[model samples]
Target: MDDQHLHDHRRLGRELGLFDTDPLMGAGLPYWLPDGAVVRHQLEEYVRELECSAGYRHVYSPVLGKRELYEISGHWAHYGDDMFPPMRLGGGGEEVVLRPSLCPHHALIYRSRSHSYRELPLRIAELGGMYRSELSGALGGLTRVRAIQLNDAHIFCTLDQAVEEARAALALIARAYADLGIRASRHRLSLPGDGAKYVADPALWRRATALLREVLDGSGIAYDAVEGEAAFYGPKIDVQIVDPAGREATLSTVQIDFHQPERFDLNYIGPDGAKHRPVMVHRSVVGSVERAVAQLVEQHGGAFPAWLAPVQLAVLPVSEAQERQAHDLAERARARGLRAEVAAEGSLGARIRAARLVPYQVVIGEREADAGLVAVRLRDGRRVDPLPSAELLHRVTARVGARGTELWADA
Candidate 1:
């Protein structure tokens, strides 16, 4: 990793006032500003659309849960070190821990209802906030934070349906990354080796690892076998991306788990009317929204694409005389579902510079205003001749709605 590139991103995020970390409140915990919250909401909306299209049901769960819950799900033994210490109530009673993952909570919900084979392929998703105790030294910007919102989902499928379900999850992940202008490398099917990191049961590990290889081989997606990266309970296929600075990060992951259901004593009636444990697949297309946003900020140098840009259009009036006109233009753009804003206070040149700093496509001025058109410049240095505001709106709306890169090009 280039230390300078990472440093540059930290500088940009701080300069933009998006987020901050304080040593007093503890490291790894970030406080998001209003502007940062807007970017987060935009990312959530995008993920929600993707999940809905992929047939995943959205649900909400509590951020804190009883101690026994994680204990039952094996997270206490497997993930306890990464979790915050339990909170003790005033009365002598059980303790609670802030949730580190949504799976255990979602699993409880599934077990609440006695499921049949008909609901075998149940996929529950949540854009849930989670907490972990990260080493203070590891915390930096939004990339490594104590509080994180994960695009998480868990799929409960029968043994026969495991491969198909895994493929569908992979497809959803691929489509999401592609749409967001993120390039994912070929999948890496991670298997457990005869190492301390893996489970001791060689037979069970072999079987679970083979299932992943079979699925990848059948799907015809090129993948390399990575040793010693499997989750404690099962094997996983990780979708990784090397960032602009050449640091490889796991962007998404799909794990096929066989042991968790058995450990939790989860069961469903199968087609043969026999009680069977459904296999669990834990997957996330975009690992963490905070991390993804950080990557995007560096990837595009904070000049986000129209669909993801916090402020899509920055309206600038040439002089005080055109201020009202600028405000009017901003309202019009907002009315058409674009995120448009007028410069609060500054010279025309200063306002344009400030606007450009936050990633916007068009900067309108008096010449185009007098001509009944809007002046537009793209991030890539392309200049477009002024066109009528309504026409410009149509073009922009189409591009934003379609999530097209050409809009950036055409501008």
Candidate 2:
């Protein structure tokens, strides 16, 4: 089969019951099916764990903000075309709009309390929702959506620490991609070209651009420097990925900004007991959960690794005689936090074919059930010697816990 036919996420997603779009939901809005939700939830949890270990403090913020907030952040000036229009109460009351980005709110959070030099580097993270008024023609599947759940974080640190923070963020991104089996097509140093779209401060732009260059060079990662692709306020390092059609899109980013700190007047007390502005570093390990899942769906061709498979295991009974045993095994697997279900409505062969994409399938026949064992079938079509049900579950659980890419760690 051709590459596009084999790896198209839109087709694979629908066939696997991952996600679907409906007319009533509007264009650019797609609903996640149960299986898709499971995948998204797992990815979100993984990101939270990764960020927590790296000293990021997660927070919750409102999705809607006053119009004045975006205006202050310069989003209204530079990004108004892609933002949803403001909604207001009757008779010129308070007007609000869905936030196009989380940076403004995070900036507000930092300014909420005074900080000392010792706390100069404050890493704030959120699995937050934001909206964009995308054009109808630009919408397709989860790749381009109006509502986005972004795994976004912003770091407030001194100028001297910004490069190191950006580097750490890049390393975290690399770790996540390796675990997920996603690859970077390229690393792009996105700068602001001679365009009216960017904030017009030549000195600030030059400084931020130089800092991002330092980050990429220090990491020893080769990258292409592209112009006219930067954020309105600053330059960034964009980790790019290609789709099944060979179209390139950014999957992750690390950006450095001095503009937002000035706009929000964010400051921390220095060693001399004086207020000083802090630099803002924006980064995302996974840009959008929807897009990330889409990439995974194609990258793995809907046969995800053991830990990421929507249905990790299928328990099949040879006949009615072994049905009870199948249920017992499934229950034990679930109790151990595995995604498992008993498939007994059909012949064992038919059930096995149906669960081809599942990472593991265990069959219980009269002989196996009588011996309290299971006939294990790996997804790659390898058969393992019959083993005690308890032992099989133990090995599978350990493999899943470790997020091993191989079907069997020992193998």
- Give lDDT per model, in order: 0.79, 0.93
Runs in model 2 with CA error above 4 Å?
none
lDDT, candidate 1, residue 395? 79
Indicate the TM-score of model 2.
Answer: 0.98
lDDT of 2 by residue, 3-28 (tens): 88778898889989999999998998
Residue 125, model 1, lDDT: 93
Model 1 lDDT, residue 3, Cα: 54
Judge candidate 1 at residue 306 and give its lDDT.
75
Alpha-carbon TM-score of each model against the true structure? 0.91, 0.98
Of candidate 1, the 10-residue stretch with the lowest lDDT total is 402-411
The numbered model that scores best in lDDT is 2
Clashing pairs in 1: 28-146
Backbone N/Cα/C clashes per model: 1, 0
